[model samples]
Target: MGKRNITDEEIGLIKAMLKRGMRNDEAHFHFNRQDRLISPGRIAQIKSGKYGGDVAIANDTALDQFLAESQQRSGAPAKAARLSGPDWGETFEADGGGGFRVRGGETDTVECKLSFRMNPNRFAEVVKSIAGMANNKGGMIPFRGT
Candidate 1:
């Protein structure tokens, strides 16, 4: 298929999902109930770097924009096994540190984290991962020093 991009409607849905301010699990419950194309697992995988699509990200100060970058960076890959990759299972600890992902209205994935406080190595690894993703045609937006 051609380079897939998030559509206007999908953007609305994603923004709506973002607006709710819920964790992946909670968001999944809502999105699944609505029977949308993107799943909760897709959301997590997208965030964690398990999945990515072709799209140049836009710069913005909005949480959704920043978060989209974060998910693309630290989150798992789409092919990579996720915290809840399978369809039957769907339960995740919302450390906020756990990194949440979302992809829609755009092909790129987004990852976000809210850690209590991590050491240098963990932070560095996250950076490496983000850079890797960016180089691989993906993007990242890990939030540290919060």
Candidate 2:
């Protein structure tokens, strides 16, 4: 598939996000929406100064404004959960109630667990799954059950 092109303004925001202590994966999650795709690798390149080196970092005020605007656009609360898969293809957002809404089905980067048990076997499985995700591109696993 063709990758979405990122604009200079977005590059500035990415730089600012990194400078402000946001992880590359988290930055990728924030910027890579369903309609837009910013690869984690691209975020890494920006973090390492291999890309967007000429773009200026966005100011604090601009960053705040951008984040606010993003929340508004997504119709999410001030502290709603926003997550994406490794390919930056799918997005999961808070439903404003107590649940989350996902746009696509499970992928290599997105796993959904209907319930989570605290038993030793379940805990081991969860840890192994998380480690696998970390080894690959970062991913999100939202436990729906208590």
Candidate 3:
């Protein structure tokens, strides 16, 4: 079967997801279901500003609703798991299958990274983010493996 073209609405949602610190692969995972497949490269294009310039970002409310509905469709819990204290560690360790969703995307106390390589630029960015978080009550910097 031919790959389905992502709609404007989906593009908007993808923008919102990217804004919320979701990586391209993560956003792609949300849209690329078994019945409707979209190329990962499309998501990379969107992330790199090569696509979806005309589309408006979906609001957090819309994104949240979409996530809830997606969870329901997948038979997962309607509510995303909250990351806090020891529970956060337990959640991560327990969900060996990956793809677990966290409630309340990125916040002042939480930052998400796609990965952490040895490159100086990326390292510096991560350090700056950590310092910023440290300045304000400390925070978690979760790396979503690619």
Ranking by lDDT: 2, 3, 1
Q: lDDT of model 1 at residue 130? A: 71
- Global lDDT of each candidate: 0.43, 0.72, 0.71
- State which candidate has the highest lDDT: 2
lDDT of 3 by residue, 16-132 (tens): 999999867667767876688788889988877777777888999999999888766655353335566787654332234655543434444556665677697668887888887
In terms of TM-score, how similar is model 1 to the real structure?
0.23
In candidate 2, stretches whose alpha carbon ends up further than 4 angstroms from where it belongs are 1-4, 81-146
Consecutive 10-residue window with the lowest summed lDDT within model 3: 89-98
Root-mean-square deviation (CA) per prediction: 16.6, 9.4, 10.2
Q: What ranges in model 1 sit over 4 Å off?
A: 1-22, 27-35, 53-60, 64-146
Could you give me the TM-score of model 3 versus the true structure? Answer: 0.49
Candidate whose TM-score is highest: 2
Residue 112, model 3: lDDT of 63
Instruction: Write one digit per residue (lDDT tens) for candidate 2, span 22-78.
Output: 878767766776787667899998888778788888999999999888766655454
Q: After superposition, how far is residue 69 of candidate 2 from its true place, in Å?
A: 0.7
